[model samples]
Target: MELVKIYECLCDPTRLRLLHVLAQGPVCVCHFQAVLGEPQVKISKHLAYLRARGLVGSERQGNWVIYALPAKPSRELQANLACLQDCARGNPVFKRDLARLKQIEPSCAWVRAGEPQKAPGQCRGG
Candidate 1:
């Protein structure tokens, strides 16, 4: 029952989309806001929910906070995510998001390579 509650958190489309992006690798909060085209407050809210559910992990790097999937998700979680990935593969929005992420390259400070333009504003909480 407790696990079910956590799984339910993943049911939200926005959170699911965020999960898909995080699965690729860690992403900066600003980059996520840019890609989702959502307000920073909304993105922050959803991110907080995802983190509380233990579906994602975050790290702070300088002024940016980057998010990523767990290195070793439980078998059940991993299986479910695999299915979600397949279903999202053909989604136009998902494709566009991926493309945008590629273009941005290293938008998150923790990103390993590629210099990204530092977005203006104080870094928000991850």
Candidate 2:
């Protein structure tokens, strides 16, 4: 993990939010939709970008893909993430996003394997 690569990924708001949510635990794509209120395309694009940079990781669970932080992050990533966590505390948007994530987490659709039946018009992988 090069420092430039980590910073580049962290520079984007969407990517940073994604990482913030992920710091707590793994999240399904649909849960991201519910929490972020962004179109799946946009979320997926940022997620793919982070994944490509090795800042995030994914695992396929049936039709859903769960995204999470890397199990063993580089020192740079760890330090930057800690900074992000601290900096986000003063941002209203980040605060709201974290609150929403907490609200949705208990009943998150993919809580059990093979449990999330797709709702109509739910975002599917591109």
Whose TM-score is greatest here?
Answer: 2
Query: Where is model 1 more than 4 Å wrong at Cα?
Result: 106-110, 113-126
lDDT by residue (59-98, candidate 2, tens digit) is 8866778888888998889999999999888898888888
- Local accuracy by lDDT, each model: 0.76, 0.81
User: What TM-score would each prediction reach against the true structure?
Assistant: 0.82, 0.84
- List model 1 lDDT by residue over 1-126, tens digit each: 656955787778788889888878888888888778788898888998988877888887666777888888877778878887898888999888888777665334437553443565443322
lDDT of 1: 0.76
lDDT of 2 at 96: 85
Error of 1 at 63 (Å): 1.0
What is the Cα-based TM-score of model 1? 0.82
Clashing pairs in 2: none
Alpha-carbon shift of residue 14 in model 1 (angstroms): 1.0
